[model samples]
Target: MGGPNLEVFKFGFYIMFPIGIMYYFGTNLDSKFSVDGFWPSKEQSNKIPTEPEDIRAELERLRRRRLERRATRLAEETRSQQDMAGDGA
Candidate 1:
C-alpha cells in the first residue's frame, strides 16, 4: 500500500490540517468569545513599578493602606461590642 502520490498527499494533509484548524479557531478569538469589560481598562489598572525605589515606595504605600483598613475595622468591631454590652446592661 505504498505509492509516491499517496505519500505526497499524506505529507500535505499532515501539514495543512493543523494549520487550517489553527486558522479557523484562532482568528478573532479574543473579540468573539471574550466578555466585554471583564478586564480592567488602562486607566483602572495599576502600573507595575520598574525601579527599585519605586517598588519599595509602592510596597510601603500598600502596607500603610492595609494597616489603616485593619485599624478602622478593629475600631468598628470594638464599638459594636460596646454597644451590645450597653444594651444588655
Candidate 2:
C-alpha cells in the first residue's frame, strides 16, 4: 500500500510537456531572429547622455515640454467643446 502511483507522475509530466516545449522554442526563436529594437543600436545608445546631471536636466526639459504641450492641447480641446456647446444651445 506504500508504493507511489506512477499515474500521478505521468499526469504531471503531461501537463508540463507542452509548457516546457513552448518555453524552450520561444526562447530559442527569440535568440535566433532578434529584431532591431530588441537591443539598442549605436545611434540610439549615443543619444543617451553619459553624465548624471546631463541626464537629469534632459529628462526635466522633456518633462516640462511634455507638460506644456499637454496643457495647451487640453486647453484647446476644452475651448472647442465649449464653442460646440454654445453653438448647439
Candidate 3:
C-alpha cells in the first residue's frame, strides 16, 4: 500500500515526465521533419491572393477550365461513338 508521499511523487512523476520529454525533443523537430519544397516559398506565397474578390476570381477561372476540359472529353467520346456506328453500317 502506497503512502501519501508515494502518491504525491507518482502524480508529480506522471505530470513532469512527458512535459520534460516534449521539451527536450520538440525544439528541433520542425527542421528535422520538414521536407524541402513541401511548403510554399515567400514569393510563391506572395503570389497567392488574400483578397476575397481575387480568391473568387481564381476559383471561377479554375471552374471554367475544368468545365472546358469536361466538354472537350464529352465531345471526343461522342465523335468516337459516331465513327464506330458509321463503321458498323
Compared with the true structure, what per-residue lDDT tens digits does model 2 show for residues 27-86? 878667768687877877857788999999999999999999999999999999999999
TM-score for candidate 1: 0.55
Model 2's alpha-carbon lDDT is 0.88
TM-score of each: 0.55, 0.47, 0.50
> Would you list the C-alpha lDDT of every candidate in the order shown?
0.97, 0.88, 0.93
Which regions of candidate 3 fall more than 4 Å away from where they truly are? 42-71, 83-89
Supply candidate 1's per-residue lDDT for 37. Answer: 91
Clashing pairs in 3: none
Better structure of 1 and 3 per lDDT:
1
Point to the candidate with the largest TM-score.
1
Clashing pairs in 2: none
Clashes of each: 0, 0, 0
Which ranges of candidate 1 are over 4 A from the true structure? 1-38
lDDT, candidate 1, 35-56, per-residue tens: 9899999999989999999999
Tens digits of per-residue lDDT, candidate 3, 1-89, equal 99999999999999999999998888898876788798898877757779999999999999999999999999999999999999999
Q: Which ten residues in a row have the lowest lDDT in candidate 1?
A: 30-39
